[model samples]
Target: MNVTGWQRDALLAVAEVVVLAVILVMALLGNGLVLVVLLRRRRHHNPLHLFMLNLCLADLVVALFQVLPQLVWDAKGRFPGPDFLCRLVKYLQVLGMFASSYMIVAMTVDRHYAICCPLQAHRSGATQRWNTFILLAWGLSLLLSLPQVFIFSRSEVAPGVYECWGNFAESWGLKAYVTWMTLAVFILPVVIITVCQPGPAASSAFCCPLPKAPTARGGEVSAAMSKTVRMTLVIVLVYSLCWAPFFSVQLWAAWDPDPPQNGAVFTLLMLLASLNSCTNPWIYSAFSSIQLYGKLINILCLVCLIQTLYFILYM
Candidate 1:
């Protein structure tokens, strides 16, 4: 528990540095490929594609601005260069985290309407509505995370060290904010998204819930339904399982007197959250079936997510 021992934190710090560096490499390369493909393909006009492309772009920023600095700061016990840089990183981290969560929910909603409200979904104005929805999601994310900028102030805690997510050690309001932020950022999003997923209806929406194999008449119903179910289950399961404990731990930290035992528990929380980044992309790659669009989606998602996960871990 004593982080005072140089050797104890040093080795772990070195590992963090290496891992974060690797993560940045993967993120930049993967997302860059995705962004290029998305732009050149002229697919950004599609609502889903538009949202996804922007999501990748946002996560790309997250990797560079958040993950890279987190490991370096942790390793060195302070950030190098200007104090503003530390604040900038932390602020962007909050922004990206919130934006990613919102985008996921938005994706779920888009799919839900496409299936559950198919008639309206394919109407002439559907495309325009989708674009508006994408804008709303981005705007909302920006607004939601703006408070972070106001909250963070760069501080030099030692001769050469700077801290950003600091001073929350005393303010009870900050703890409460963390508690709520965790719930809003992680808990509620997963629930709403899972429930709103566009999977095939089981036997009973009213009676006995029975699994029904989708009956398709040359449409994407069967395939889309199956993918929806598989993806919904996988994404929700992983996100909830990994993040629930992290949020719980934060809640505990907010309310309880004990610090995390050896910081490993918190680090574990970080690891699980980070897992979402890499694993989510792979999930898309594996789950999207054989559609032509699968490859692009997988590449974009993987690139963005892997980088995002790195920061979640190192941050």
Candidate 2:
């Protein structure tokens, strides 16, 4: 059977919408659960837990602002709203990307400081320092995303047809913008995470050592620190894996005159980038205590079951 071009495009659009919808639901459920568990805990003051909370918030932003809006745009086949909405959505989409990337960097750097500079980690005003890091991560994200507001607007791309579009300079503008975004959002953060992560031996020695004392408290602390380090590493690894291809594709499309914009492989890779938001909560839950993991598994299963039924009936 031969499929027409329009039919193929329709299939692609449907696939994209389904993928985004799944990503949005998983991100909301997983991160929402993580947020609730963190908030309910008496030890919410723990620096690692606080960072995880912020990370979940960042993932929620991605789900709500980035994935959700894109899903709508895909379904409608155009941007649907006023000029203000167009700009606002563009701003938030980039903001989510920045926040998610930097939050992980901040978390990794904190762990590095704790393991490499134990004295500084335990010094007075540690809580304030951690708060400062969190504030800086979000502050930078907000500040950096301002460009989206000015660059993107509801524009008349065709006669009597308007869509949310970016205004870039004729020749060099798009290339420059994409290059800068790739650097700011992905490249630089990966460099920081790489530098901050210690080797396995060093991490093991700093985070967990052979039991010198028979006390359970000492063992518990060692185990907790080790788990925290491992968890942070996993999150960073997953983030890099998920986003690297997206940024690479963006760069390629921007620089190459005849890029593979319609390539299925490229499109799928870009779509899968948003899966990072969905994976963070699960990674944290897996590393957490058995009680926490059990709680999350139950809710996660329920959400999946409900979503499955909804898709079968409606989608």
Candidate 3:
């Protein structure tokens, strides 16, 4: 069947909304499950699990406030709320992104110290200190996102169609801001994670199989630490791949304000970036045990179904 340009555009818009909605659902459910399971488990107060909880919380913030507003704007073609609400939404969204990135970095650093420098890790990573790390991560994220409060404003895109947009005074300012954000939130964190990854011998510090077994302590600890290193490395890889396109496009838009229109492509890129929030839980599940691996595989199959449907109907 053939479709006209308008029809095709309408389909694409619908696909964007549906895809974003699916992402929100998956992110909420998967991260919520992580929170719930960790909270209900007997060892919930441990530093490592608490750090995972922080990551889940950050992903939830992105799903609920960040992606949800974008989804609404895409579906409605305008900001549905007042100027103040728009500013708040934009601020929260950026804060969530910063928080998620920093949370991952903190996780990497914590593991690196724990595995590579046991005595130092024991001294520096006490319960109070871990609390301070969590606090500092959230505090710095909010502080860094403060500029969004001043930079975003509700602007009229068409006659009576208001949308939230950057209110930078100059093009250079916008470019600089986006460049800094890209570096701080994406590039620098990935580099830090890469550098902090433990080598094979360091893995022996904290190895244990995901499943409980009466195995030799040394071998188990080595295997577990190796898996942990692999898992975090994979996370950083996925995060970079998912976010690079969106940041690249941002830099391009900053360079050329009147860039050529490719709305569908932009939507696809945004969807890929949002998928990062939905992936961490699945990554954890994959490295955990056979049971979780099976369940995560099923979830992945469903996600593939949704992506296929969107491409078939809209592209």
Q: Model 3, 159: alpha-carbon shift in Å?
A: 4.2
Score candidate 2 by TM-score against the native: 0.88
**Candidate 2 lDDT by residue in tens digits, 49-81:** 899899999999999999999999999999999
- In what order do the candidates fall by TM-score, top score first? 2, 3, 1
Which residue pairs of candidate 2 clash? none
Assess each prediction's global lDDT (C-alpha) against the native.
0.64, 0.88, 0.81
Question: Candidate 3 at residue 19, lDDT?
Answer: 91
- Per TM-score, the best of the predicted structures is 2
Local error of candidate 2 at residue 103 (angstroms): 0.5
Candidate 1 lDDT: 0.64
The 10-residue segment of model 3 with minimum total lDDT is 204-213
Clashing pairs for model 1 are 203-210
Prediction RMSDs, each to the true structure: 8.2, 4.7, 7.6
Backbone clash total, candidate 3: 2
Cα-based TM-score, every candidate: 0.76, 0.88, 0.82
